[model samples]
Target: MATPPKIPGLGAFADHKSGTPRPATPRFVTAAAWFLCLAAVMQFIASVFAIMHSVSPERRAVLEAQHAAMTGNRPSLEALQNIDVITVVLSALVTAGAYALFSIFLVKGRSWARLGAGILVALTFIQLVGVSYPEGFTTLAQVVCGVLAIALCYLPESSKFFATVKSSRS
Candidate 1:
């Protein structure tokens, strides 16, 4: 068998104990990457549904009624429903798309990607919380994914992957 190519820094699969020039990509980061990607896919699906239903009169009526109930003030269907399509598209493109893009660099143990993911995950949780309480399984799923992504990235098991060699060695 041919020998594997050696990279100068952050090469493949360097165990935590090894004195390699670069730290290995830990399992936690790997898991977090998958989780973030999954979140993005799910968010995209949600956006598509929002857009598809947005033009339906029944859907518009239901949303308007729900809004009025939550806000304790009646609002016209045109006022409430007009924004749904644009809102969902913007959220998908910006929020979910950014998460998907950042996850690529995140796997390489980039600190900025890690920090961005953290902030994105936090924003996801905040958005989830804004939803009405006593939510169903779908809302729970969003919260769980966000929390899990944060935990996987920051927990000690995977933290070494992002640390500088000098710090991890000390």
Candidate 2:
């Protein structure tokens, strides 16, 4: 086989035929994409838990007392019972859609996938910050979830996938 000619600075990367830069494939990034999908699943589960778990009677009493103190009268339980289930469902659907988009981008090795995952990680981190300042168990879980999502974003498979995407674009 004839040795391909090398351009001085390009070294082994020099192309003899087209003289254009070629891209190399990344091996690990695709696996990290699963994190986006898993987050959507977890969000759905959290929404379900939020909707199904009733407030404890003690909590309700505390709320009632607070309300009475503020309004000079007890608020009816019926008012509390009027929770908007539709809103929660809609939020879940939106979250699921975002996940689907992210999954598609990840699988296809689109450059946008990295941006999307980064944005998702940032959002999770913001949520964690909000949770942490409050010092509640709920916030702790939020932080854990955020950490997991961020970790997944940096997984070898995900990095490889994104690298392939970057190379392809070049």
Candidate 3:
């Protein structure tokens, strides 16, 4: 196989076929990418914990109602335990997929990815505003990851890298 030729206007790693002069990816941008990966993993774990070991509260209530109507008693703990696990598992999978999907685009330096990341970060802040952090390191780590991902994306060097990618598009 032929080694790929280096081309004008391309970054060191860019394929010669592209012939686009993408700048070296900025350190801040790389940091942000890694941080996003971390956030995705954390979110997956959190989503699992958010739904573990019990049926959803609403569904559990409905099941208890039915049981009471039929036999004048509530649903058993054992019956409620795994009844909603499948639904919760599916939701957790979706959450994990979204994180992985978005991070792939962000790492590629797609403009839409940057915009989406920005919006997500804004939403995160909005969701958490004035909420006290629970006593856990994960929440703090998540905050740091979110803040860094947003802050780093707009730095001068990162902006230049993004601009170069845009300007050099074929």
Question: Candidate 3 on 75-132: residue-level lDDT in tens?
Answer: 5755655656666577657644655555665566655666777666565455455544
Residue 142 lDDT in candidate 1 = 55
lDDT of 2: 0.55
lDDT of 3 at 159: 77
| Clash numbers, per candidate | 0, 4, 2
Q: Candidate 1 — which residues are off by over 4 angstroms? A: 1-21, 62-83, 130-139, 165-170
Name the top TM-score candidate: 1
Sorting all predicted structures by TM-score, with the top scorer first, yields: 1, 3, 2
Ranking of candidates on lDDT, top first: 1, 3, 2
- Which model is ahead, 2 or 3, in terms of lDDT? 3
Query: RMSD (Cα, Å) of candidate 3?
Result: 7.5
TM-score versus the correct structure, for each prediction: 0.64, 0.53, 0.63
Q: Model 1, 22-63: lDDT tens per residue? A: 567788888888888887876776666667777788887788
Query: In candidate 2, which residue ranges exceed 4 Å CA deviation?
Result: 1-27, 54-83, 129-163, 166-170
- Candidate 3 residue spans exceeding 4 A from truth: 1-16, 53-87, 124-140
Error of 1 at 170 (Å): 16
Q: For candidate 2, what is the TM-score?
A: 0.53
